[model samples]
Target: LMVLGLIGAVVLASGSLIKAISMIILGLLLGQINTDVISGTPRYSFDIPELTDGIGFVVIAMGVFGFGEIIANLGMPAEHREVFTKKVKGLWPTKEDFKEAWPAVLRGTGIGSLLGVLPGGGALLASFAAYTLEKKVAKDPSKFGRGAIQGVAGPESANNAGAQTSFIPMLTLGIPPNAVMALMVGAMTIKGIQPGPQVMSSNPTLFWGLIASMWVGNLMLVILNLPLIGIWIKLLTVPYRFLFPAIVVFCCIGTYTLNNSSFDVYMTALFAVIGYVFYKLKCEPAPLLLGFILGPMMEENLRRALLLSRGDWSTFATRPLSAGLLIAAAIMIITVILPGISGKREAAFQEAD
Candidate 1:
């Protein structure tokens, strides 16, 4: 619970506090749609059998990020839909650019490496945190959201580093730290490979090979991306009218295939509408996603802790580790809500506007 609170605080600091909290509350409510684990009774399932198993992550993700974005794009005026097709003179960075970027990259990597190990911390969280850190520490904070090289370098480096390190929890403890890692766990299960500490000893070859492949993959990306930049640029020239329909079709196909259920497709459409509402309200959906993912886990752990303590309700504070975590969470919330910090946060966001 404390970890989830801390994560929520970080997310809250990233944007408008009231909007973040509202989205998070909505996410928590949505997470309650399935059956209760402890009571073996239906929760907010509305007597629907299809909802008893809870909503799939893919459904929500595709609905909000895929269809919702498409809807927003379609709603905009045609004048706002112009693609940037300016010719590029150089693909590589200059020496001065490298010099400026390296320090940010190093800081981002360090931050990402640390955060990726935490439950629910992954590329998204790491990148957000890194960007916020860069903005806060920058000599001229106004440069952010204005083609600042530090803003780009920091977040990209953190994203890559966090993506690599997020495999740690899945590999060592069989606990996926993020959605991608959860998919990786599913893939490993299909391959008849259990993810845990035993894998290192029992399947050293597979374990070590996976680690080594990351380095190879990174090298391959650099080699391929440099030459493929033009192709990517050309892709942007495609009209939204031509591109969006294809994307919407693919999203529908993907959602329907998840369980071969038409209900899932309907649910996705519903959430897409909800997502569009959020978009209109300028509410970031990322924190809501984090809440949805962590909500059940937090409930389960809280229940287990209480059961073990015979419902004393003091186990959380009585334990040193949990106490420390709660303290940290409190400190983070206090820091974000302080008058001076809140004012600066608003100012920073306004600058971005």
Candidate 2:
């Protein structure tokens, strides 16, 4: 899974291998700086006691995206507003649009199903890859990003499919592919339930019930959204001052509920400021959250693998299957530097991004 994810990143990078390498190094550093619970040592705590617990992923995400989004929106002039269609029209797509979208949706579903099984691959990557694939396959690729129905339908379907299949790894293998699945694992642990292959055999009702709920949830969402879309649009038309405070209040409540810790609330406030700064600098906060969530797990696994191999670093490359995956990832990275391919890859990404 890691190899697959690395290959995806490499392919996506085009000629930007240096940037990819730096981002990885940064993630590794963040992971290492986090406190090791078993060792009870803080690597980058900077003599601050609050740092010992390490920064929470939920806090950072809320701060960077939730609060930061509100802050950024608030910075824009109040009179500036989103342009919306003045009239309400039928929700269904036209016949030509439907025809174009169905094939894209089917292709997206297939792509999402395959990628969702990989660790670290989730709805985001599935949507991204699907959109890219759709653009590549489209008869009029130039239509993408300018009210392209295929662009919307393909990614939306892929994300939904990816989200559903992501549960497979979590339920059957006790491995979470993303942060949400990690939370699901924690929730299962809290309920005195172990998640794995045994979950299906030992608790048939719970397993089947969960599976049924996904369909029910999808139906409910469609029914609810149809009526509420107008209300949502109306809410979007509301002034930022009126809306952002409500968002901030909800974020604070959610942050405090994490451990009922006022300290977390305070930390969230600090991160809100940091998030705003990042927003002003046009920096992305998503990778930091990913690093925070995946870092410790990566470190723990690396440590265990090394210990099992008696500290022999060659184990990663010595195994046949492992070597093949590594070689594939390496090849993808190397290809990004090739002359014509690099230019075209960069152009594709530049268009997409």
Question: Whose TM-score is greatest here?
Answer: 1
Candidate 1, 53-164: lDDT as tens digits: 8998779989997899889888999866645546655657789889988999998898778667766556766776677677766767667655578898998888888888
| Model 2 deviation from native, Cα RMSD in Å | 4.8
TM-score of 1: 0.80
Query: What lDDT score is found at residue 166 in candidate 1?
Result: 89
Candidate lDDT values, in order? 0.79, 0.72
Model 1: clashing residue pairs?
none
Off by over 4 Å in 1: 1-15, 86-89, 93-163, 174-206
Going through the candidates in order, what is the number of backbone clashes in each?
0, 0
Which candidate number has the best lDDT?
Answer: 1
Candidate 2 per-residue lDDT over residues 1-103, each given as its tens digit? 4544545543543224455445445545655655785577787978877667776666876887788777776788766533332554554567998888899
RMSD in order of candidates:
3.8, 4.8
Global lDDT for candidate 2? 0.72
**What ranges in model 2 sit over 4 Å off?**
10-24, 79-163, 169-209, 269-284, 348-353
